[model samples]
Target: AYLSPGVSEHQVLDASYLASLLENSTSSYDYEENESDLNSLPCPQDFSLNFDRAFLPALYSLLFLLGLLGNGAVAAVLLSQRAALSSTDTFLLHLAVADALLVLTLPLWAVDAAIQWIFGSSLCKVAGALFNINFYAGALLLACISFDRYLSIVHATQLYRRGLRAHVALTCIAVWGLCLLFALPDFIFLSASYDQRLNATHCQYNFPQVGRTALRVLQLVAGFLLPLLVMTYCYARILAVLLVSRGQRRFRAMRLVVVVVVAFAVCWTPYHLVVLVDILMDMGALARNCGRESHVDVAKSVTSGMGYMHCCLNPLLYAFVGVKFREQMWMLLMRLGGSDQRGLQRQASSSRRDSSWSETTEASYLGL
Candidate 1:
């Protein structure tokens, strides 16, 4: 269960009836007489609502465009491959699929942000569930990629040796299954409801207080901390091995791993930190006032947008960074233009030679 911008979730659940009464109050003189009694009412945040109206739609639309094009191209390229996939390729393919699915939900959110949840209750749950499923799936798939890289490079082993195809299929199935489990709350609790204060409909979860707190904690742990730990440990060990070895190719691969970790942290850290604060406030660990609520609400809105930008960055970091993938993309483009087979064969040979830094290290680029 979560909150959208506008009226704070804490305020919405606790004070909506009071807000409705105040909205229905007609006499200014009666309000003046009872002004002291209404002093404790949650303050209206015109700025947050106005910001959502102007800012969220534009940002969401931009994210949708960039994420769609990048992830779509990634999916197309990976799918075009005729040979069997390595473990890293399998992980990357699923990551692209998850990101593409997540991006598809942005247009609906864009509309919800600009206007209201006019799609009604059923679509609300479906969209919200899809969003949650893919968000968690992307994070888990990234961890899987890092773990697969760690095994191939540092341990000098594959994630599976026997029945490689079966293992890859099982891994993907497990990832999606876990994502669905994590997002079960959304499917069960998310619904489109009218926010009388902002005079707009919002699609948000309606979990009990304990459930909301638990879900937020789950998000912080599973979505951010676990992935961070796995990626950091895997890459740190990979870098250690690379540093001991002597080659410019190894150095370049080392730099790539560092960029991936840093990019993930930069894109996701602030949003999770904001979520932490939200949890604290909800649990009464932090003082909850309208001023703080307003600021956190706005901060969450902005940081979550920044987090979504990573969907656009993943293709660049994971796919385009690979020499083999780039060569494949070029061959794909050339083939579409009726290029000769001999030229394609020559380019493929050159790419294979150039991409071979080390068997294990090159696999990090999905070059295997």
Candidate 2:
């Protein structure tokens, strides 16, 4: 190589040094470019897709059958006795209604999970709103039932004593109104939209990120946490009162209490916890990547199905467990089946004596 006359040995760079520097710079640039490309590429997220297709449809279909049958039976029994409904009866009736409404929407979700959202946008919004509305109403009514039990037992105040059926009806109206308010967002934002990645349309929330976060937070607090807190407090007080009392009713009440608490926790807590994790991930409070997101997706699906199954357990836990309810249900079934009128009358007369004794017990609401 030729050097300029003014260039000194110190000022001139050796060929090897220049070559090494150029190589280093090129490698650094290439690494940076590669990093940028990786960041820009969409991450693979098929971890839960196959699992969801196989799992969600079956879970949803089973829930639909169980919930519909259970809630429908409760509704029939409650409606048959509507003229003489106690405050507890009124709450149970509405709870059954809420659960039924929620269950009716499950078929749509099942079809969506198995294939795609072919129901179109209007039906999607309506079904989504109904599902959410009943979800809130059911939880609130459970809280109301707990409170009713507290008043009837702990305070020794008979809700039906003062012609409070009107009050109970009004409370149910208020619950429905509040649930409607909570679900308004779903009506406005949910739609069946196409997903290119999945090659299907999905019925889902369509909102800004901030709006989604806010809506989810509201749901978590109002729908689940608030009701859970209310039930916890009211039942805790009721349990304290029941503990000091003496009777067979006490033992039965203790069992009823355990069943109620365990059933609620098992069905609901996991779903809400997974939802909380998702909310945290959205807010950047938790580390999130494709793998973690896929796991969360699977968890949400499984847990939400578990939550849906809660509707099936409600009728068993709240109604059939009660002796009075069982009698009423038996009467309803006999009538529906065209059983012998004379036999029905004899059974009714017998039940009246048994019911008189049951009515005096604190757990009469449970029909225990």
Candidate of highest TM-score: 1
lDDT for each residue of candidate 1 in 1-368, tens digit (9 for 90 to 100): 36222234644564565676667777654767778757766766766667777888899788888898999888777776635356676778899989999988888887877877889889888888888888898999999888888888889887654346788789889989998998888788888887766667878777678998898888889888999999999999988987787767777877788999999999999999989999988788999887887888788888888888899999998887776777688787888888998989887677555543112444434342
lDDT of 2 by residue, 210-254 (tens): 887788788788888999988888788877988898988788888
Q: Which model scores highest in lDDT? A: 1
- TM-scores, all candidates, are 0.90, 0.86
Clashing pairs in 1: none
